[model samples]
Target: ELKVEQNPLFLSMQEGKNYTIYCNYSTTSDRLYWYRQDPGKSLESLFVLLSNGAVKQEGRLMASLDTKARLSTLHITAAVHDLSATYFCAVGGLTGGGNKLTFGTGTQLKVEL
Candidate 1:
């Protein structure tokens, strides 16, 4: 079984602020991904961190990976109202004789004013 965890299950941020979301896994994984979901919408793939030190960014969001530590992070730069959403991190690896994605519980970010 694969287990993924994320910290700060809920976040209330103000515009022009910054924050980071952390993700940790119980087992080894070569793949980690970041996704965002708006209310009443489907999850949107934001970044795919495949190798160690892999980092990706777009707009106000940045994501990095550390395979050795089974940790990943999503950093929010200059938070804005439009950045409000639920973020998720999924760790993928061989499991049950196949590849599976273990998703974190998600961190809901609320940017106001």
Candidate 2:
């Protein structure tokens, strides 16, 4: 079975700060995805890491994957109020029939001014 563990379940930071969220998986995975969700909204895809050492960045968020270590990281640079949301990392692995995704508990970020 594939299990994912994410650190810093809750993060409170000031605007213009930087932080990183980590995701560790128990088994090998084919793909990794990062998602963000607001208080009352559905999840929004942030980034997708296709291969080992793959990195993607948009705006203030950056995501990277290390398939060799079964790890993924989401980095936030110059965080702002609009970046406050719950972030999730999902890993896709080959199961019995098809690939399945297992999500982490999530890291809640609160950016303050």
Candidate 3:
């Protein structure tokens, strides 16, 4: 069975702070993805790491994947109130035709003034 776990299920961050979220998986997977969702909003794709040593970043968030260790990381830099939202990491496995993804419980981030 493949499972994904994220630490710090809830985070309270002040404006202009930095934090990192960790994700660990139970089995081998073909891809890893990071997404952000604001209250009452759909998920927004942040990064997709396909293989080992894959790293991608946008704005104030960075994501990296390690296929061998079955781990992924999302680092937030200089977070703002706008960045306050729930973050999730998902792992995808190769199925017959389409890929199946298993998501983490999610980490809610609150950026205070």
Candidate 4:
């Protein structure tokens, strides 16, 4: 079984600062994904990186995947109070029938002004 790990499990940043969240996996994975969640709410898909060097960005969030390195990253640009949420990365578990998402520990970000 592959293990997914995320760094800086807890984050506190100013509203105008910038930061990056890191995600690493144990084994070979064909895909990488990022999601965001608010307290007691469902996850919102942020990015899905299916290939090496795949990158996606929206507003203050940006995600990228490097298959060869078995790593992914989520970057917050000019963090905002509204961006405070838990970010997660998921990888592997492709069983042909469907994808079983294995999520990371999750990074909790708090943007204080």
Candidate 5:
């Protein structure tokens, strides 16, 4: 079975600060995905890391995956108020039926001025 967990379930920081969110999985995974969700909105895909050294960035957010260690990270640079949201990391594995995704406990980020 595959299980995913994230640290610092809630984060509160000031604008312009930098922080990194971690995701750890119990078993090997084929892909890692990062997502963001606002208080009352649907999830938005942020990054997809397929390989061990895969890294992707958008704006102030950067994501990386290490398949060997079954770990993924999401780094926020110069966090802004708009970045306040719930973040999640998901691990995808091949299942008997199809691909299965296991999501981590969400990290609620609150960026204040």
Candidate 6:
């Protein structure tokens, strides 16, 4: 089986709310990343965590990585309708090519207006 997993396959939240999506991996990896996708659209890069305790944020979304724990987190702050989309976390080794990505099943986020 793939090494990555995500919780809450589907989630619905009201506008201006906060929530968090968790990602867990089964093996050691050099990096963890988060991505966002809209219906019928391609994935957009959200975060790239290279080391443990690495945290990055943009707009209402924040992502953190812990290599030792083999986990990642994406936190949403004050979500808006525009934030309604699917989120995915991918893991890979540092030396491996992009082809090494193991993507999670994805979490669907719906924000009511």
TM-score of each candidate structure, all chains considered together = 0.94, 0.94, 0.95, 0.96, 0.96, 0.92
Evaluation by lDDT, superior candidate among 1 and 4: 1
Residue pairs clashing in model 6 are none
Candidate 5: lDDT of 72? 95
Alpha carbon lDDT at 103, candidate 4: 93
Error of 4 at 17 (Å): 0.8
Residue lDDT tens for model 1, 29-74: 8799898999999999999988999999999899999999999999
List ranges where model 1 is wrong by over 4 Å: 95-98
Q: Which stretches of candidate 2 lie over 4 Å from their true place?
A: 95-98
Q: Which one wins by lDDT: 5 or 6?
A: 5
Model 2, span 4-109: residue lDDT tens: 9999999999999999999999987759999999999999999988899999999999999999999999999999999999999999877799767889999999
Error in Å for residue 71 of model 5: 0.7
Candidate 5 weakest ten by summed lDDT: 93-102
Tens-digit per-residue lDDT, 1-113, candidate 3 = 88799988999988888999999999988599999999999999889899899999888989999888888999999988888899999999888998888999999999998
Q: lDDT (CA) for every model shown?
A: 0.93, 0.93, 0.91, 0.91, 0.93, 0.90
- Native-to-model Cα distance after best TM-score fit, residue 51 in candidate 2, in Å: 0.3
Ten consecutive residues with minimal summed lDDT in candidate 6? 92-101
Q: Judge candidate 6 at residue 64 and give its lDDT.
A: 93
What's the true lDDT of residue 92 in model 1?
A: 84
Per-residue error for 106 in candidate 1, Å, reads 0.1
RMSD of 4: 0.9
